[model samples]
Target: MGTWIKETDKAIYLMDGAYYLQKIDKTAHTGQVEGETFFRTGQLKTWLNSKEPPGFFLVSVGTGVSEPQPLPPPPAPPLSQGITITKSPSQVKIYQPYQVAGTASTSLVGKTVELYIDNSSSPAAKTTINDNQQWLVQSVFIAVPKPQVRNLKVVAGDASDVATLTLTPYIEDHPGGTKLNLGGSVGSGGSNRASDVRKVQERLIALGYTFANKNYETFVQTIRLFQSIISGRTAVRGVDGRIDVNGRTQRFLEAANAPQWMLMPSRGVGFYNLEVIDQPWDKHDYGIDWMSNVIKAAGIHYELAYRKNREGIAPIAVNDVSLPQGGDTIDHAGHETGNAGDLALPRLDGDFGGITWSDRRYDRPATKAVLEALRAQPWVNKSTLYFNDPVLINQRLCSRAAGHDNHIHFEVMVPPTP
Candidate 1:
C-alpha cells in the first residue's frame, strides 16, 4: 500500500515502483514536499518518495519531459603585433653590401619586410620573415656617390624603425694621387723631369685649382695660391716656390684631400690654428663627424640671432678639437678624444686673434647667446662648459675654472660604437 491524496482537480498517489498523479485537482495544486514540487495536471511533478534524502520522482503529469539547456563559454583575448630591430650598422662604405637584422611578430612571419633609404617610398631592399619570427636582409647595397650621412629605415606591416649610416669614400692610392718627389723645382726643366711637373699640375687641378702651364714660374704662383686658400688668410706661410712633396706642402695636400677630414667654418666659427699647428707632427687639425655636427649646429644658432636682427656676427674662435685619428695632443688633458673643443669668447672688435681676460672687449651678449645655443644641442653635455666669467658662472650656465677665463671648453658625449 502507498499513500494517496485526492482533490477536486487531480489525484496524487504513491505506487509500488513509482509515484503517480491523475488529473483530479482542477484548482491548480502546486506545493513543495521535501524540496520537490507537485504542480497542476499539465505541468511537471517532482517528489521525495524514497528513503534516500536526495532521491525524487520527476515526471510530467500530462506533458512530456524537456531537456536541460547548457551555458555559453567565455570569449578569447586580443593578439599583439609589432616589429623590432635588434642589429644594424652604424657605418657603411659607398657601393658596399652589409647586413641588417631584426625580429617581427608571428602575424608577420612569412611576410615581406622592406628597407628604405631616407624615407623613400620605394624600398631599397627586402627580405622575408622566417618561422621563428626573425628576419635578416643580407648584402644590402648603398649607392651613394660620396661620403656623407644617410638614414636607413626598416618596415614591416605597420611598424618601422630608423638608423643612421656614415658612408666613407674608398680611394686606391694616396688621397692626393701617386706619391711624388715633390722636392726641387721641376717645372720647365728647372731641375727635375717633366713628368714631375705634370704630376703637380694634375694634383693641383684635382684640388679645384686652375693651372695650365707646366713652367716653374706658373707652378710657383699656383702653389702660392693653394697655400693662401688653405691658410684662409692672405699671408701664406712656408710658400717659397719649392715643391717639397714630402714636407709641409705634402702634408697640407694630404690633409686637403683626406676623405675623413672636414674643415671647420672659417667665418662663422673660427679655429685657433696656432694650437693645432703646434701639436706633434703625427697630429693634424680635424674632428670626427660627431663633434663637427654639434659645432656646426651651435654656430648656426648663434649666427641666426644676429642674422635675424640684420647685424653682422663675427666668427667664434674654436680651439683644439682633435687630431685626424683622435689621440692625445699636446697641452690638452681631454681633447685626446675627438669630442672636446675650446671656443674663445667673442670680442667687440670681431677679431679672435688677441682675446684675453683683461681685454675689456668681451662681448657678453654674444657669449651668452652662444652658451644658450650649445645647451640646446642634443649631443653637447650641458654641464661640461667650463669658464671663469663671473656673470656666466653666477647664471649657472658655466662652471668657474682657472684657465678658462679666455675661452670656454666644451665636450660632446659620443655614443658607444656597436
Candidate 2:
C-alpha cells in the first residue's frame, strides 16, 4: 500500500497498480522517445462469495488506441497468481506477499539476472547462491512454468552500466487451490439523526417553515415549496440545523412530552420495525457516517447499531412527531423496542426539564457541542436542544427560535424514495 510511481523517462511497462520499472537502452539509438519495453506482474482472484477478483494489465508503448499496431494480445487474468522475483548480482526480491516470506530469496546475494523461471516457486533445483553477498549463483530454480499458471520466476537484468530492470511475476495456482481472501472496519457516529425533531424545525426556518417551528413531517410538504435551488426547484434545508429548545420555546418539551401521548399505531407508540440500505444493518454507505456524526454531536457514545452498515452509511427510520393526546401514560422501559432507540446518556449529556434517561447525568459542554456538531450534518431535519432551565434556552447565545424548553430535537432529511 505504500508504493508510489514516479514520473520518469521510463513508464509502467506492466500494471497491477504495483509493478514499477525504469527503462534501459543497450544502444544509444534505442533511447528514442518512441522506444518501448515489456515486463509482467502477477494476477489476483476473488475467493469470497461476496467479492470480485482483481486483474492486472500489460503496459507497452504504441498500444494507446491509435489503431496502430497492437503490441500483442493482453495476458489472461489467471496469470496474476504467482510470485515475482527481481534478481540483482547479489539479491533476489519477491513481489506481492508485500512482505518478507521465508529465508530463500533474502539469504542469496551474488549474480545479476533480471528474468526466467516459471509456474512453480519450488525452485526446480538448488545450487550455490551465496547470501554472504560476495558470490554469484549459477543454479536455476523452477521449470516449464506456464504463463497463466500461478508461480514464481527469476528475473535477472542485463548489466553494463544500466540501472533499470524488467519486473515480470509468474503466478501459479496451487494444486489444491490458491486460497486468497483477507481484510477488516470502524464506524463514524453522528451527533444527529435522520429523525431528529429539532433538525426538522431549524430546516423549517431555513425554508421559512414558521415562527412556531414545530411538527416537522406534518409541514414537510408545505416547506418543500420554499426550498428554492439554483435550478429553481423549491427546497427544504433538509434536517441540518437545530434551535435550542429549553429556552424561551417549550417546543422541545412539548414534542418530547407530547409525542408519547399521541395516538400510537396498532403495533403501539414505538413500532419501528423497518430496514433501509442506509440503516446500520444494511450495506455500508454515506448514511452511517451521518448517523455516527449525529450521535457524536449529541455528546453520546454508541456501540454501532448494525455491523454491516459499519462499512458505509446506514439509512434512518421513518417516523412522525406530534402533540400528545388526553389520557396518555408514559412508560420508561428498555425492551429493545424497535421504536425506542437508546443512547449513551453520559454521551448525550443527560436529560432536559428534570427528565433523566438511564440514570446518566447530563453535562452542558456535551449539550452545546452536540448542537454544534449536528449543525455540521446536511441531512438533519430538526433539533430539540433541552436545557436544565428556561432562561438558559432563551439566552442570546442560541438563535432566536420561538419555543424551546425541555430539549432540542434535531432531524436529518433523507431523499424521498421513488
Note the clash tally of each candidate.
Answer: 6, 113
Task: Give the 10-residue window scoring lowest on summed lDDT in candidate 2.
Answer: 178-187
In model 2, which regions exceed 4 Å deviation?
Answer: 1-362, 381-403, 413-418
lDDT of each: 0.54, 0.27
Alpha-carbon TM-score of each model against the true structure:
0.36, 0.19
Candidate 2 residue-wise lDDT, 42-153, digit = tens: 2111111214322333434444532112134567765222222233222221211111111123323343432223433343222222343221122211222334233333
Task: State the displacement of the C-alpha of residue 275, model 2, in Å, after optimal TM-score superposition.
Answer: 17
Best by TM-score: 1
- Model 1's C-alpha root-mean-square deviation from the true structure amounts to 20.1
Taking every candidate in turn, the Cα RMSD to the unseen true structure, in Å, is 20.1, 28.9
Cα displacement (Å) at residue 119, model 2: 50
The positional error of residue 214 in candidate 1, measured at the CA in angstroms, is 34
